[model samples]
Target: ARPRVGYFYTGKTGSEIITEKLMKYKVETFQSMPIVVKEDDSAYDAISAMFLSDVGTLFAVDQDNNLVGVVSRKDLLRASIGNQGLQDIPVHIIMTRMPNVAVCYPDELLVEAANRLIDKQIDSLPVIERSNETGAKVVGRITKTTITKAFVELARNELM
Candidate 1:
């Protein structure tokens, strides 16, 4: 017995193209209600509060609402284990700062950008763009789950 590879005249599955084509499917931050916090806020309180609000991650923004950093559950857990007083510590002290953060544009093909997740071994990518006449800022986040679900849908559509 041997294996078979399904082949069609269409190229590259265009998962990238298909993903990009589905840009209309992109959901806005206001629609999803992203978790955001000021850098000066208490890391523990903000994280705990957002968690209670059903948010899995939090974005740290500056007074300009520019994305300055990000904090994940693991980061918060590590900080908490290291210092109980982190509850009062500012989020800036615990957040993953810029130059170290991972980001993706909302228009970027979900399939192409999904590779960054495995390559960087991260759970999500902050969706951002240059603020009008200013620095970059996070507008939202795209999680692994988002891309995975999108791909599954694409696959299903092909079958149909």
Candidate 2:
């Protein structure tokens, strides 16, 4: 028997509602333009590129413009403090090489990308397209900030 004395029915729990909304988002809708550097570029150059772009993560690409590795501000910082000059150390030396790097696609669910970021303990994921025969071409990036923006926007929409 249904309780009708004082209870009112709600369609879904708050968490359930949020999850359903979040699940509907795809990475393409929230991704930001990728910041990339050549694999052979110096660590110093990578740092400069990151600083100039105001991005913490930089995708390292080969001559073919295929994503070869991923580097972070921390990696550049570590290399900068080493005995060797930052200018002398190639980005490939300090980057997390491909296959070892976590990546997502534009069509991937935003929730899955968020989970990937959490599970990998990474700051961002390079959005890649595998249709190319050369290799995976980095298309965009999904960062914690991007995910936060998505959540905030969703909340704002709900409030309105």
Candidate 3:
């Protein structure tokens, strides 16, 4: 026997919902190849290019495409201003290690993922999933913008 309960079941994937209704479900999906740098890459050149790429941080890679670390814009800039040798140095010297990385899976709920972002106080999270027998592979990126835009659209529809 099914339990009786009143539930406001919302239909999935309808353009008729308007912007507001869509906002709440506007979660990040798997997309966008992550910008990456190798562990042994020249820090100066890599950092410069990454900054110009307009990403908050650069994903550091090993010989394989596996994500190993993250180097933030501030860290790179500080290193650059402090040591001329930083240009020749490898990103490993300034990267946050894999153990410290705050990552989420592509299937994670937007509300739960957003909470994790708030708790970690990070601008974005690299969406990853374990591949075969290898390390985690990044599939997408989730930024605060993801959720905000969703909510904004929903609000717009509700108001209209």
Candidate 4:
């Protein structure tokens, strides 16, 4: 016999409650592909990719595509506003270098990742996986937009 588990008694049907519970699902369920740049790449190139991708952040990767750092729009803006040539400045100069970047694992809860984003006061977290060679490999990205979209989808599903 299966162990009895107590669930909060709401007026809604069981299926409704189950669906509602799934809204707080794991990060892997909703993470999007990351926009990546190499550490040696130019600041101008990274900014261009950000504009094209419509994202506020970009993950800096090594030649092997292992996560090495994180760069934000603000970083690029700072670099550009200082009268420095963006095309010549490398992204690694302004990136939040590895061992300092906050990251999330693919298997963690989405809500937990959201909390980390808020607590860290950042716009996104690179979803990473342990690699035998590299310390960590960026697999995906979870952003505020991703969370909002997931919430909107769940609300729409609940309404239907």
**TM-scores, one per candidate:** 0.74, 0.89, 0.72, 0.82
- In TM-score terms, candidate 1 sits at 0.74
In model 3, residue pairs whose N, Cα or C atoms come closer than 3 Å (at least 3 residues apart or on different chains), thus clashing, are: 19-153, 20-153, 20-154, 23-150
Candidate 4 overall lDDT versus native: 0.88
- Which ranges in model 1 have alpha carbons more than 4 Å from their true place? 1-33, 130-132, 158-160
Comparing candidate 1 with candidate 4, which one achieves the higher lDDT? 4
TM-score for predicted model 3 compared with the true structure: 0.72
Candidate ranking under TM-score, highest first, comes to 2, 4, 1, 3
In lDDT terms, which candidate is top? 2
Q: List pairs with backbone clashes in candidate 4.
A: none
- Please give the distance, in angstroms, between residue 103's alpha carbon in candidate 3 and its true position after superposition: 0.3
lDDT of 3 by residue, 123-160 (tens): 67777875576786777777676667656755676422
Tens digit of lDDT per residue, candidate 1, span 1-160? 3335674444546576755556545434212345788889886687776768676678888999888888888878788787458767788888899979888775665554677878988877778864465766676777777766776766788311
Residues 1-160 of candidate 2 have per-residue lDDT tens digits of: 6567788777588999877877788888889999999999999898889889999999999999999999998898888788999989999999999899999999999989999999999999999985848699999999999888877887689421
In lDDT terms, how accurate is model 3? 0.71
Error of 1 at 21 (Å): 7.9
Residue range with the least summed lDDT across 10 consecutive positions in model 3:
22-31
lDDT of candidate 4 at residue 140, scale 0 to 100: 91
